[model samples]
Target: MMMMQKPLLLLAALTLCCCITSLHAYRKRGCHCIQTTHNQVPRKCIRKIEVIPVSGQCRQTEILITRRNGHRVCVDPEEKWVLELLTKLYSENETSSRTNVSTNASSKLDA
Candidate 1:
């Protein structure tokens, strides 16, 4: 009876661990947003913006906006203002990268 109890306890422990592991993986693979807004948020209040593209886990593009007050808001990616904002930021990044490359090349030439 003692040996039987030990095996049963071991099996229970393994089963519980497997259940917990699968639950955690499910949550990580799920979409991050529960709800999102379509209304335009004020640019002045925005502290940072994160754009997450669609993948096997998330079906739609997600735009997470962090406000100055330290609150995060999820905005609809298809909104006109959102599209415009992403486009402007993309251009700025491209220009900044180009400027950095040119500066580095010039510095190397000088050396």
Candidate 2:
């Protein structure tokens, strides 16, 4: 009985250590992305622009051009429209820290 109890306690302790280490590693490997609106223009139509944060404070801007021909295109232009869209998107989709962490972990596994 004593021998069995020692091994069980050791196993429990090892499991706890592994859980903590994995949690830390996961946090370190994940990133936080935020989208924000950079600009919008009314040139016969509304062109919404936004930026998506790829990692940390780094972002990629995208422009959504709404043409008079009733067609909308998403483009990564060097214009201010991309910034506008990013801002709007980020504000609307911003998740809590816990949710973000889970999403990051899942994304990492998928990648």
Candidate 3:
């Protein structure tokens, strides 16, 4: 029984590692992308980024994004629309976190 459990545990760990590795593949930095030409169809992918943590600051660090059709693309990280979208996401997160903290504090005080 104990031997069976050991293998099961190892398998679970391996599965988790594989999942994490695959997730990182989808969030790859500096993906080798071809230069776009006028003839190709445009991808409908939305930009996503892995915000890097450095010196206690969170910063947009890459051009990884996905399409509605599950396709991934590496875009120009410094594009104006990309920056605007990142800023919008960050602000939304900040406000939601503040609201959560305030709600938790009020509940604790009422208890």
Candidate 4:
């Protein structure tokens, strides 16, 4: 009985340790933003924009903006200003890509 109890106790300790390690790993990979702000930041002050899509690690989309002052802000994705900024950026990307494609095709034709 004593021998059996020792092995059982050892097994329990090992299981607990494994569970804690797995939980720590899971927590490390989850959600970059703790909260999002609704205040509208002027475009001139923004230095960079990062849009992280929803994935298995994060449950929702995250928009992180870096300011010229070197501060990072997480903005609510659903805010009206945020939506408008995203639309403008996306359209600019589309236009830029189209221009690049057209230029490439023309250059190839000339060659």
Query: Candidate 1 — which residues are off by over 4 angstroms?
Result: 1-29, 99-111
Residues 22-94, candidate 1: write the lDDT tens digits: 9788755657678999988887888877766677778777778888889888888788998898677666766
- lDDT of each candidate versus the true structure: 0.72, 0.46, 0.47, 0.76
Most accurate candidate by TM-score: 4
Give per-residue CA lDDT, model 3, range 1-111, as digits (tens).
Answer: 998999999999999999999987884343233432222223334433443222212233334455456665545545666566667666676666654323321111110
Mind giving the per-residue lDDT tens digits that candidate 2 earns over 11-58?
Answer: 999999999999778645332223323344454464332222355433
Candidate 2 segments exceeding 4 Å error? 28-35, 41-111
Clashing pairs in 3: none
Candidates' RMSD to native: 10.4, 11.6, 13.3, 10.5
lDDT for position 96 in model 2: 26
Give residue 103's lDDT in candidate 4 (0 to 100): 34
On a 0 to 100 scale, what is the lDDT of residue 32 in model 2?
29
Cα error of candidate 4 at position 25, Å: 7.0
* Model 4: pairs clashing at backbone N, Cα or C within 3 Å: none
Best prediction by lDDT: 4
**Two-way lDDT contest, 3 vs 4, winner:** 4
Q: Scored by Cα lDDT, where does model 1 land?
A: 0.72
Error of 2 at 14 (Å): 0.7
* Ten-residue stretch with the least lDDT total in model 1: 102-111
Clash count per candidate: 0, 20, 0, 0
